[model samples]
Target: MANNQRIQLKGRVFITFNIKAVTGLHIGGTESGIEIGGVDKTVIRDPLTNRPYIPGSSLKGKMRSLLEKYKGLRQNQRIGQGYIHSCDNPEEYPNCEVCQVFGVPGERDFATPTRLVVRDVMMTDKSAQDLEVSGRTDLPYTEVKTEVSIDRVTSAANPRQMERVPAGTEFGPAELVYSLYDGDGCDVQKDIEHLRTLVEGLQLLEDDYLGGLGSRGSGKVKLENITVALRVGETYAEEKKLLDKFENLGCLVEKLKELQDQIRQHVGK
Candidate 1:
């Protein structure tokens, strides 16, 4: 019966925030076509604007990876060249927060709608303008950082240049859209809980790092100026702000019950 059921969209919660680069952030992109003296590693950028931006896939993947590790979930599913944790058992799909929020393989018999959508974050106009005219940036709105590695056997030093968005730069307003659903043995409760998991993932990301070169000190980020709104069921046409501008995820964490209460008040109708 569960396998034959259909899922229905109940609502969506919108989370918007700013990503402040506390340290030089590096999310590598192709190093092709650079001059001999150019950076060997480069941050990913929007093709149209040539401004380095955070890809949704990068953030979402990082969150999922962190959550999986936190939950001690098994990494059994192979995705491209990497392996990610996925609960293959349909029976367990509804119960696993990672799978419920991130989703499972399409071929799975119990495949249900994934509840989360993370959007690519772009630079704020102010940041873009500041970096553009600052004259300190090596490239457009970015800086080149050179790093060195010591060869163990040869006892030699090899230096490589990496492109990064300079510290104190901000990219936003970052957005995450979370969908609530019904049917298929799932209810709004599960979706609501998944929302909690979603927020937790973001919290995990802040403590961890974003992009590459994290271990050696890069990709440190903070989520700030967060606002959460919702559009639910009968009132789907109208967007209501559950939580007004909060400073960070920690603030939201303290108010989860209130957030849930606000959601319940709206949806219980």
Candidate 2:
């Protein structure tokens, strides 16, 4: 009889945060989203309507907020600088780098948002009726690697500065439109501010280079897709699920734009 050694998986999870800036003239800044708070706050804007859409900056900002919670940092202030060199300190340490370089200190330049791709790895081991650690131990296990990529507008080659979309040619499905909410004039104005914040966070990265450290300036980020992957016992079920979810979300976004069009038609905005 053979005793089966339970296969344990251990590996690094390369969770990538693909940050990018906002592009597309029709959709850039003000004209896109709605106002929520004091000013107009933007959420993800519809692509086909020349309206507001959530920028990658918002996603990264939200992630940074979440990370702060995990690290028990102050809520009021922004996180450390990103992976860039703004001051001379980084040149000296060569180790303890600053955060702002990666768009931490102040709102990163609209031109470029410093994206610092960070990763953490963990391993696991199992023993077949054996134990070894400080004294003595041995273990057997299977390693599984997984990663999730949250890609934002990280690409360059600004489309915002491009010539206007041909008049009356029908903006493609990629064009975004703004949806007007049912409310008084002031109410509508408020939502606009909220929508803008989300829009400002968008940063584009190059496409040629996706993750690796060196690829930082190689390519740019585009609004084409957000891919995530996972591995489980030689089967990457999570990755498949994530991709499907991404597709579904994209579809829903399109639907939202259609709804916005209806609003524009009825209200005559």
Candidate 3:
């Protein structure tokens, strides 16, 4: 007799914040890696030797970690369970915002919709049957479209800084994304100064370029080219002609200068 495949289970209602910043920071542990030109280079660094390259796996791994941490997700113990799935501990169940939605149940673990993802979930150890896997769990989510920019130091130890997008906005999965700028966001100059103070505490070569801590032994950064352009003109007309191209090149120079300084500081040159 074919019994009905219906079983009572709980559903969770919570938000999962996706990565809006640049991806491909890891030099290992396959996520989505960056291709310098044609070849996919690892962006992580080795702890023993400092060098810069890209690691596809690293990129993906970090993203997974971020999502799991931010969402307070548990590991799926199942074999083919999807990444970012749900955890239902038949043991002492962890209280979660999503779990609360399902009401209190002692027998079954926290069950979620099954998801099929490229990589396995790294954080959880729950069974595969308990996970809700997908390429991205946000596929079914509704994005609250609002543009907000934040200006934060890209790195404290490095001169690199850029305006980042604010949190809480939903955008489709992108390799890299930034928040819109707003006055409420962190002051760019002030943030940079703060980073300067913290710079000394950081060891350049000892850190990975893209991935943060575990990636410390993954890859390194290399300075490629530096081009400086000078503009000369007193009159508005003359200045305008030279200024356009020069101004564009000048920006590149600033970035290069920052990169140069970073290399020198790290390499102790």
Candidate 4:
């Protein structure tokens, strides 16, 4: 497929899930210097309410990176070096799974549009009230964590403070939207494959960390109360309301697997 090729929208799948911090999460914000008597590192917050929230970019970027790594699509570069670019020619690399769902950069020739849409995750009001009642008196909805790095040569310690969203905080409702395109000719199964890949990506994200400082135990999160809905045609009446409800993370994974299997069977036929 080429960028000039025509593509038609078949349907869209909407996935909604909640993210709960299993451990303290530190998605770093702009650095406030010690000169201002502010913390060395701060967590991003809502300006109006001053409540810490996870940016959609953070979650989407993390999921894309993890999925790329899982599919061995990562570039041959050292950590903190550079990012891998997606395939430029979809016709040449027709089976490039990551590029299909996540969309290729600078690839106007790619037939399919970007399939995934991730929304910014906000802290639930219930969770915020719980934090206050739990006696977290440091800040309104965040905690300051003190960290230090020791220089082995001189045995000197450099200390800094970081702001983080404390453990057990719940953020929702996070939404992930996946677009399904009508495949060309015998490749009609492409939409199913893409959805399966997206599901797998989310599963991988659940097993991994979301924000910065993962090696030091920050950014561990769990997805909860996942619900799926589908819109099959152009009109609102064509919608399939709440197709499935997943009670827990494990149940969601299982449902995805079942859906994948069914698609595989259909393709085989």
Candidate 5:
């Protein structure tokens, strides 16, 4: 249980896919100065393209949150307004699925390399172009919806504008780079199994939602057209495709047991 053994880098797994909005999606953008009733909400956009994109941080954080909630892990780490679970105990950290996959603070003695890295997902070219030319959409690459918050006591109606990506719009070529580390041991079975954790998070997201205002019917999404590949440490330069063009993450989840055997064959050889 000593923290002296060097952590060995086994390899890395790359998962690429498409995320389609099942419902209107709203991931808020920053507004420096806002006058009353002037677009109360806006979607985050790429500075260069001015196109809305799903940030890696948002995607990764949501995945972690969902996994933690599913596992019913104790909420200890306070992030912004909400709390998240993080194992402070080195002995217990290895057993916590959330910690093992998402990782704890690097400063912690028990901290290992975080297994997952979710990349920012951009709006598909076709979706962007279609939204622009449709002329039916309220905004460029997005739509605006007005909702009123009625006061119970005074019955005052406070209406606010919300910007969202229209349902059926696709944002993808999204990628999740998961690391495989053999900590203090040559065996990387645990690292490989962490793949399940990633898939589980994706599946949970499908059942749940992404971005904000999920309860009020925004952020429902689905993953599709997945491609997974592996890069072992020995043959790092030559990456091998494991599951080429799986229909969805659910398919990957279904065959994870067999997939592990495939990974073992590639990495072990």
Candidate 6:
């Protein structure tokens, strides 16, 4: 008979941060396809506000891809498969860290719930106002970056226009929530380990790029003012109290380490 068990909610950790463009950022949007006159690539934007924004999907996808590559988990079978690769074969590999946090596809019989939730990043009010004052005059809040590709044989330069959110643009504060579970056989250590991995993934992302055209001096970004809050147990009161415990990125990491040490002590008992 198959084992039947359900995971129970324990608590949650909420992390908030800011993303500032260090170079032109270009997360692509739908092509206008006005063949006569249109940029080759366009940045994604908010329809109502008409301001460029970063999608949570784009951030999460990029982080997962970077972490997978760092962990050497990017085998041929998993490369474009979209997080569905199996980790059920314990003999081959036990406790796949990536899947446990990011989640495996529904088809995986042993799949657990995804622990991470990334929120869409919107432009700060000040950034929007700055754009308005600067007066782009032509493209509004975005910059039209032009590039030329040389033909190898004829050495002819072909120019194309690319739309991007320019450097110094700020969009955030981005939010990420990590869920902790409670159950009879819950492994708290695993949850802590997952948190560490997730934070490390963000650090790796900071060292890398956010959107597209990274190779051509676009998409460099910096994450700042990271703050984290944690709530324990299953009550609104506890959550309310936890709101006062927000800490900066450094303090938060230290607290997590302290928590891990305490858990280790209890487990050792």
The model with the greatest TM-score is: 1
Ranking by TM-score: 1, 5, 4, 6, 2, 3
Question: 39-118, model 4: which lDDT tens digit per residue?
Answer: 78788888887888989889888887888888787464344667764665546346777777776654354545777888
Better of 2 and 6 by lDDT: 6
Model 1 lDDT, full chain set: 0.86
- Estimate every model's Cα lDDT from 0 to 1: 0.86, 0.27, 0.27, 0.75, 0.85, 0.73
Colliding pairs, model 1: none
Name the best candidate (by lDDT): 1
- Model 1 regions lying over 4 Å from their true place: 1-4, 240-242
Per-model RMSD to reference = 1.7, 25.6, 24.6, 3.3, 1.9, 3.7
TM-score of 3: 0.20
- Minimum summed lDDT over a 10-residue window in model 5 is located at 180-189
* TM-score of every candidate relative to the true structure: 0.95, 0.21, 0.20, 0.87, 0.94, 0.85
lDDT of 3 by residue, 1-269 (tens): 01332322111111111122122123232325544432222223333333222233444344334444545566554434454434455333333422322223233434322211122112112211122242232211111122233457653342221111112221211121111111221222322222221221112321333344233222232211222221111221232111111122224334544633432332221
Count backbone clashes in candidate 2: 79
Write the residue-wise lDDT of candidate 1 on 120-202 in tens digits.
99988899999988999988888888889999999899998888999999999999998888876568876776678888898
Q: Can you tell me which runs of candidate 2 are displaced by over 4 Å?
A: 1-52, 74-101, 105-113, 116-269
Alpha-carbon deviation at 79 in model 4, angstroms: 12
Q: After superposition, how far is residue 140 of candidate 4 from its true place, in Å?
A: 2.1
Q: Judge candidate 1 at residue 100 and give its lDDT.
A: 85
Off by over 4 Å in 4: 1-4, 32-35, 74-81, 183-188, 237-240, 260-269
What's model 2's lDDT at 160?
15
Task: Write model 2 residue lDDT over 1-269, tens digit each, in one string.
Answer: 01332222211112222223222112123434433422221122344542223343433443344333433443444236543233333232212112321234443222122223332211112221122223321111111112234446864442211111111111112212222222221122222222222222222122222222212221123343333322232342334222121332344244434433432333332
